[model samples]
Target: MRKPVLTIFYQFNPWHSTIGGVQTVVSNFIKYAPDEFEVRLVGTSNDPAQPNGKWQEAELAGRKLQFMPLFTLQNDNFRSLVPTTLKYTAALIGHCFASDFMHFHRLEPSLATLHWSGDKTLFIHNDIQKQMQSQENANAILWRRFPQAYFQLESLLVKQFNQILSCNSESVKLYQQKYPTIADRVAFIKNTVDSQTFCPLSLEEQQEKRVALTQKLELPANTQFILFAGRLHPQKDPLLLVRAISALTDLNVHLLIAGDGELATDVRLEVERLGLSKRITMLGSVIQAELTKLHQATNVFVLSSAYEGLPLVVLEALACGTPVVTTNCGEISKLLPANCGVICEERTPVAVADALRQVLLHAENYPIEACVRATEPYSASTVVGAVYSDMWHRWKQQNLVSTVQKCSTNFT
Candidate 1:
């Protein structure tokens, strides 16, 4: 029997990039999706050289998957909404006809194509209103002027989709309260990590890897490493981490930032301004393997994001047996087991610095085993993948029943 076609629409291209959380989630879903379903992705590309309107075949977990880049947005900071919507809507209308089920990662891309009918799912990764509010405060006067318009769009999306997938309990609760009529449609599917690859290292192994990484980056030995691995965006607040590091005058610590983004230059300037250029290293956009090693080598992973869905890096760090010091953003505080790490009360530099210092002082009490054990329920193959499988089966059965009822009514 031919398999059902599942097409996903998102903002980032999943070809060979490892920049954003959405891309990581989409890539993992494609990797772990049941073999009985055929998967395809429609997204935007940052590479100006990538040709538009082309289907590229790639293999994941021994299965073939197709990707179509509808448009190229050279500058990542540019949000040319009208042009992006027009080009993507035309591309989706032309190519998405054969899909039995559609999955959308963001609301903006799905706005123009809402007229297309199918069994559709919308995965809400972050609170759209909160994010828009933050954007308006930082930049984008348009968001401030027409905030209600954005809320209306979000409400329309919530009402239109057949199913809503939320990454955390907080989002699920928020949606349930806002759209009580469709509360049953919202489900939680936590983010996952590859447990095998990100597993804890032995003492000797950690020391060896630490030495190699330090030497590779030209840092001294016997120094404590604290890692922050995400885009240097306003939402992530990478400069906060730098400020916290600068305040720790008495500790022999080094901060390693392992990603780049819109605020890269600003982050660098902040590091220099704080006179932490030597104490901090900015490793811009390392591959997955390097990230895993960095997690294993570090004493603590820090997440200073103003908000999030459920960060995959936090799970990955826990899987590697590294503790965390993070703000109470998203469901991270709830997800963290006691003694696995520290959850700050606020996102200020003083709070983060205090949390990091405490974690560093008693780091040995938070065992590697404890960190790894906390992540057992979030393993990619066993837990996360099974949830997706169950969702697909349930939705398919519901659709079948609805179709049968329609036919019966027509015959009557």
Candidate 2:
């Protein structure tokens, strides 16, 4: 039997060397994709050579990844928009002509998928337009930078995919509402964690790791550590975290933000102006091991994202048996079981601070075991299995449909 072909496309810049949720998602997919399927990953980033050509291909584990470098000219505003779109669209059309089925992973590729007539599946990680606009306050100014024609082109291209897979129910509902014609095609598949890498650490292990981490960072034990781990983008609302820390005067809570982005300097200034210089530590970026240790050490894990499909950090914190304080954005409320974590009010510093205090002070109310158990369904194997199953089922259905049509034509 011919192996079902899977093609994943995205814009990934690993050289920046910072860990974020999208990076985790792609890495996890690459990590867990089954051997039975023939996988091809195509993506672009800051790769300089052969800017308009397919740079190279590599075998990661058992899967194949093709990294194509899209050339962008300096001072050319329509490079990623028109040129990248045309190149990726050509690539997808070529893949469609060769492959039995296609699993797309980004808006850029989705545009191409729409143009190519094939068995297509799209994985929705976030509301891309909302996410783009979120960086409006930051230097991105995505809308201002990208021409209005780009949105029209993207919207036009998105309508062509045969199936859509979203990471959360909220995304599904929102997209269904936004694009009612494709409501039936939208499917729900949640993100997963690698249980082997994210399993429960022993009490002794937790204590030892936490102590070592705090010692390395020189943070005091008495200080309430509020951990925020992700890119310091405007969407993440890093300033709100600093503002929340500034609000708490009664407690010796010290905030540790473990990530980097465009707003890092602005956030640091906010921390200083609030007189929280001593209480805040911007660890910039840390490795996965250190992040796990920080999770184990932290009293509260907070995410202040303006929006999210479903955050991996929240799942990671739960796996570490740490309580979380996050906004209602993302599928957070659904992820937060009866005793998992605290859901903060929408986008307000006072509300987030108040929610943080509640979780920190009443930490006992949140059962650590339950939260850990809640994350089991999101294990990498489980989640990847879901993705594989859906793609396989769709591929079979498309084949059956084609066979039936062929038989009908023969009879006629």
Candidate 3:
């Protein structure tokens, strides 16, 4: 029998490098795709070699998955809008023609899935309405300024998808309220990580990693690190983290930031003004291996984001036996067990400082064993692959039943 073909389309490249949680999700979905399916992935590429207004496949000599990209996706200015839209629309339409099942990411390309007469699903990674309030990135600006238009767009788009899988449970409920007709179709599914690649180190290995961390961050060997690994944007609230660090009386506690974004300069300026230059190390964007090491090395992982949708970094850190201190965002509260997490009730510097201080003061209470346990339920291999496979099988069975019913009526 010919296996059902699964085609996934997104707006960013997830196969090559780590960009954010959305890209991470895309890569994991590809990695853990069902055994009975033939998978195809398509995303945007900014490579200069890719010709304009064309969809081209990437060189898969050493790559994990083959990819095709619409070259004009990056520059979203008025001039390139028509060509970019045409390229991705044509590419997705073509892929749909040959596909039995489809998974889509991002808003526009996902909306294009409506053009296809196949089984399709869309995954929600964030609470769009709340994220717009943050105006954290360029994309959020338009939503924030024109709230009515944003709501209309969401109401329209959510109606198109056959099923909507959301990372945050809260987001699922929110979607239910926003679109009552599609409430039954909206479901909660947690984002996952590879626990094997991000597991905790042994005591001796931990000591060595700390020593290595000291050299990498140019800090004291015995320093207790608090790591934050996300874009340095207002939504992530990196500056709030900087302020929280300044509020902390513990001189031994240091913050290691592992990303760069629009607010990078502001973060640097804030760190300098607060005289936290020595206490904070802005590592910028590091590779996944180095980030895994950072997760393994740090005393605690922290996120001061204004909003989220079950962030991957938190799971990765927990999988590496690192405790977390984050604001109540996404479905994060569910992952953190007692003493294994320090969730700030408020999004203030004082609240964050207090949580950080608590974890640093009573480090033994937050054991590596408990931290690792928190991430067990969200393993990608076990959860992501199985979920998609089951969904596709059910949809295919439904289609078969419908076809048989139509045939019986015509024959009679």
Listed in order, each prediction's TM-score against the native is 0.90, 0.83, 0.88
> Whose TM-score is greatest here?
1
Query: What tens digits encode model 2's per-residue C-alpha lDDT throughout 56-101?
Result: 6665545565545344223211123444445555655544433555
Query: After superposition on all CA atoms, what RMSD does each candidate show versus the true structure?
Result: 3.0, 4.4, 3.7
Query: Candidate 1 versus the native: TM-score?
Result: 0.90
Return the number of clashes found in candidate 1: 0
Model 1 residue 196 lDDT? 66
Tell me the spans in candidate 3 whose CA falls farther than 4 Å from its real position.
51-66, 72-98, 135-140, 402-412
Candidate with maximal lDDT: 1
Q: For residues 230-283, could you state the per-residue lDDT of candidate 1 as single tens digits?
A: 877777888888999988887888999999776889899999999999899999
Candidate number that wins on TM-score, 2 or 3: 3
> lDDT of model 1 at residue 17?
70
Which residue pairs in candidate 1 collide?
none
Question: lDDT of model 3 at residue 14?
Answer: 56
Candidate 1 residue runs with Cα over 4 Å from true position = 46-50, 73-95, 135-137, 140-145, 395-412
Ranking by lDDT: 1, 3, 2
Q: Model 3: per-residue lDDT, tens digit, 339-404?
A: 687889899999999998888888899999998888888998888867776776776797799899
What's the true lDDT of residue 16 in model 2? 33
Evaluate all candidate structures by whole-model CA lDDT and list the values in order.
0.79, 0.72, 0.77
